[model samples]
Target chain A: MKFPFLKEAITSLTKKPSTELYPLVKKEAPEGYRGRIKFHADKCINCGMCIRVCAPDAITRTIEKTEEGDKITFQFYLGQCTFCQMCADFCAKKAIELTKDYSMVGTDEEDFMVRGTFIKKLPPKPPVPPAGAAPAAAKAPAAAPAATEKPAEKAEDKKEEK
Target chain B: MFKKLIEKGIEKSPWLLHINTGSCNGCDIELVSVITPRYDAERMGFKLAGTPRHADIVVVSGPITSQSKERLVRTLAQVPDPKVVVSIGSCPRSCNVFHGSYSVEGPLDRYCDVDVSIAGCPPKPEAIIDGLAKAVEILKTKRRGK
Candidate 1:
């Protein structure tokens, strides 16, 4: 009887099973693992850089005009996401982050969506200039541009006619 | 009493039928790894079925391409009642980066209802296991209802 693997079998008898007890024992995804997306609405400047860089078009933005400011709502659809981290990489405000949570399992489509909202206040008007001064100040610049434009137009006409 | 016992048997061991409808092979690789020794998905009573008729859980990967759309629908229809449809990766759920391609026609829900969606470019093996566990739970509920 040739038992070629007798020594190997004896060594295997003492070895522990390689199978991971997955459900019973939870495991964490490694650091910098691009998984779920986290959008920081407050940190976002509404630059729209992330939207431009996203290959899947997973990020959607809706702007609503309100008394306070522009209410910008951004929706990140995880289902459509490729987990490429490009959106986070292009974000100028560091508003988007790819978390290490890999267990992004869900039944409903809504469950896979990540949303964030932020208001961007409009810039203040230039002190209003007291009403009377406003028209005069505005007229001065407006008239100056018109005056410069008329001369240029006349010169172009003369050239055309010649 | 025998009916209840049959249901119990079905709940304990739910066989999976993997269908790739134009996948880039990323999710397929991860799914194969899940069945390997290190991950060993079989320990949880999940087995890969050879045919759709024998499947209790249908794991669909990839964006449904124009060519594979018909076949995908036909395969799902064959998976008898009380079957759970699980979409692995962002491709099946929303077509991922392949959304606007002329050849791709998917986001799996258009054909059949997806019970569990595991979102990742190619989800980690652990995540795939988690999704499978959820599929198993859904399978139990479906079986009980039937």
Candidate 2:
């Protein structure tokens, strides 16, 4: 209502903004800021606690046994993620962690969702013995017992023949 | 005659005083955001007052820790009579994750009276404004016919 107040307001409006532009310009988040969890596939032990603690049932784990060992893959649905960062905190091996990249916008709901967020590396298994070794294992005991019985049986047969 | 005059004063202007007991700064930041360019809480005839003496509403954030109890008690005492207190987050409500800590000294009511509670880890900004509006309504009803 006052001329002085109006003049000050106009002058303030003409000045450059003091605050940084956000969302469009993209500000840097603080280090270790809890945003979304990224999985380190090779390091995961496949303990499955991350799946258990998820309040929304957003994670699913699939396990398969191979000649090598066990293989595990986990799928995470981002649409249901609450961004609570509880999953990363509870991970025992520190294989899962939250990163500060909050700019997750997508048109397709499926594309935005991250199913199979974790994969695990398995230890190499020992090789099976050759076929020849299996025959030796089966033949040794039978041959030893037969050798002892054959001499006794031959003596008995010789007496009867006499 | 004096009662009518006091009632009129409570309706036209309601000032708020904010106290932080101990929070992750999420609720604190959101509370400030309510006053910024987007929400601009002042348009609703609500204003942030510097001292408790000038306030009708007290907005509290965080779980009450041992370190914060004394300060909160002193501040609440300073606010004038016919006041309303609003607990702002899940921390003060159930203490959330910090519920069973050795140093936590609150459920808030142990120290002072609370009229309304807005429950969220850090409640959304729109919900915070809604809570404030509700508090003002309660203040109006309490003032009438007194």
Per-model tally of clashing residue pairs: 0, 3
lDDT of 1: 0.92
Name the runs in model 2 displaced over 4 angstroms: A1-162, B1-6
Summing lDDT over every window of 10 consecutive residues in candidate 1 chain A, give the lowest-scoring window: A124-133
Residue B126 lDDT in candidate 2: 62
Report the CAPRI category for model 1.
Answer: medium
Candidate 1 local lDDT, A15-106, one digit each (tens):
99878888899898888999889989899999998889989999999999999999999999999998889889888889999999999999
Could you give candidate 2's per-residue lDDT for residues B78-113 as a string of tens digits?
998778888776566546556568988777867776
TM-score of chain B of 2: 0.91
Here, model 2's chain A TM-score works out at 0.59
Q: Write the per-residue lDDT of candidate 2 for residues A36-127, one digit (tens) a residue.
A: 45777766777778888876565778787755566677776553455577777888888776676543322233533454433344655556
List per-model TM-scores for chain B: 0.97, 0.91
